[model samples]
Target: MPAALLKYALSRKYPARHAFTRRRDLKKRYDVVIIGAGGHGVAIAYYLSKYHGIKDIAILDKGYVGGGNTARNTAVIRSNYLTEEGVRFYRESVEMFQGLSNELGFNIMFENRGQLTLAHSDAAIRSFRWRAEVNQHMGVRSELVDRKTIAELVPNLNLSEDSRFPILAGLWHADGGTARHDAVAWGYASGACERGAELHQCTEVTGIETKCGRIAAVNTNRGRIECGIAVQAVAGMSSIVADMAGIRLPIHSFPLQAMVTQPYKPLLGPLVSSPHVHVYIQQTSRGEFVIGGGSDPYALYNTRSTLEMKETLSAAILELFPFLGQARVLRQWAGITDMTPDYSPIMGESPVEHYYLDAGWGTWGFKATPISGKTMAELIATGRTPDIIKPFELERFYRFQQINEAGATAASH
Candidate 1:
């Protein structure tokens, strides 16, 4: 590892020395209070304190920091969407991720090992062209590759002619990759706390107190917290929070499930996915084969893993690599995702004047943590949403303008 990368990773270690111990009191008021201490909330707090000079902030979570979807995801990060806005926004995120460790003075353990989305059908190939063109137009490094290229990327890949969803081509995203999800949340939280932001775990937000159409304070399980501003970065509970403030966002809850196999020698390098198969697998640093796929057929808020999901996901995984059929699944888990109709985020102002929303992330929320923090910080501090995030406003539902990246999001997320 590079010296800078090593240094960055070391700083992200949890409960950094000199970190502030938790404080308990309802009398203290914060300038800003963000809900959900996952990667998004932590990053938001970090940017608010580090960039906007708003250090009197508090991040409250129902559990420990990053104990939510931040720890459950497969950690795939990419920007190879088939839409213009999606590509540009995520490309900016990818660029930020490159030096994020340095900027935050913590090691995020970002690995740009590239990502290949296999195409099994002519239609999948066509979609790849559109995605490649759109990504390239936005200055992103994405392109269509032939079977030979795919073979080189994953020599052990099974591309038999008669196999189900046989790989014919692929969309190669050169800049796409993965990161240590926990490290990201910890890095942001550690840095933010170092800058004087308060991180409170085991703090459950139960209600949003508003008066005269503006947020007055937050009612939590711990107690009442008076705040000047509140940003809800909670992924699954986004709708519940918005409803408390009488702000109806177009978001539906669904459970995204993933399973991992027992440890094995490093057999995979670049992240591989088959949109046609709807399954993705990557070997972690600990040698677990982290496996994940699309959302369930039904909309659900439950985070419990289902037998149907495991069977379906496993079938797809085996179809891609028959040799892995015997690999035992060590564990299966699920996380609730707040999926917007557009398959993108719904950020910016809500019905309540003092409440800002950074929700509707669906399964792709983890990848956008840093960018969302940067953008949301600017939005809250300047009282204006940046152009990049304006298109994702809640009002877009009325305009019927949706940025759906479902195709790209399904296989990899």
Candidate 2:
């Protein structure tokens, strides 16, 4: 390689740890107080200061920014959802990601190679046909591909007829892809900082003081902050923060784990997943085989990986690509995901006045970061939930109007 190419590749070794400058002194009062400094919360600050012209903002997190779900996700981006509402909403998110690098003035390394969800049984193929129709009706690039096309797309896939679960067809989504997760969170944090937003790491919100059914102030480990509006964008700890405001949500926390293999020559391009086997696979830009699976069987607030789940995922991957069985495992990690009954995110208003919510994000939280931030900021500034996000309101549970995305979000998120 030339010297310039070598220099650029070497730059990838040392990553920028601190994404934004911080404020040592937390203000006694602010216009907005956002809990959780993950991608969603940070993006909300970015838009509030950049687009809505609200600068008196403070973002509080118990740990470092992007250290939670942002760092643990498989980073697969797609919009081929089951429902029309979901398809429309995620479609907008995918479109926003295409221009996010230019918008944030940072390169997120978005690779739109596409995604293929394999089908094994005849029922699975029928479901893909419906999903492809819904996706195409919403202007998403998806088609039902045959086994021959699957073999062409993934040359190393095991396509023998005698396998336990034979590959019949797949939903080929041309718009599905992945991006650098760290760069995205940092980009939003840096933009928010440049626009006069304050980021307070290691500052945990412990209590919320409500005055006459409205938010008056928030008590943190450091001190109390009086704010005009407060938001609980915390992913895993959604119930804890909402309880502080005298509201209870229908959410549970579970662990979602993923593992990676040693770097090898790049082979697979588009992401491939199997809902029947409960596994998803993608080759990263650095050549590691990035594999993701469904949430743990039991509910828990832990981030520890399990041996049984690893064995299950390994067996499924081997069925798809037997060549990877010999590759040594590099590392395994987990993140707590807040799951809801409908398998859809809980966004927009909560029961308490002046207290917004962005929870129940499950394994799909990373993909919705940009749109969630934009809509949540709009709701806080205008005091009205954006029309686009109305389908995901908290009252949807009581009204029995669930979006019912459980089919698509289960193993493929």
Count backbone clashes in candidate 1: 3
TM-score of each: 0.94, 0.95
Summarize candidate 2's per-residue lDDT along 233-280 as a digit string, tens digits.
Answer: 899899888999998988989999899999999889999999999999
Once fitted onto the true fold, the runs of candidate 2 whose alpha carbons sit more than 4 angstroms away are 1-19
In candidate 1, which residue ranges exceed 4 Å CA deviation? Answer: 1-21
Model 1 quality (TM-score): 0.94
Instruction: List, residue by residue over 135-154, the lDDT tens digit for candidate 1.
Output: 98999999999989888898
RMSD per model, one decimal: 4.5, 3.9
Instruction: Pull out the clashing pairs in model 1.
Output: 8-106, 8-107, 9-107
- Candidate 1 differs from the real structure by a C-alpha RMSD in angstroms, to one decimal, of 4.5
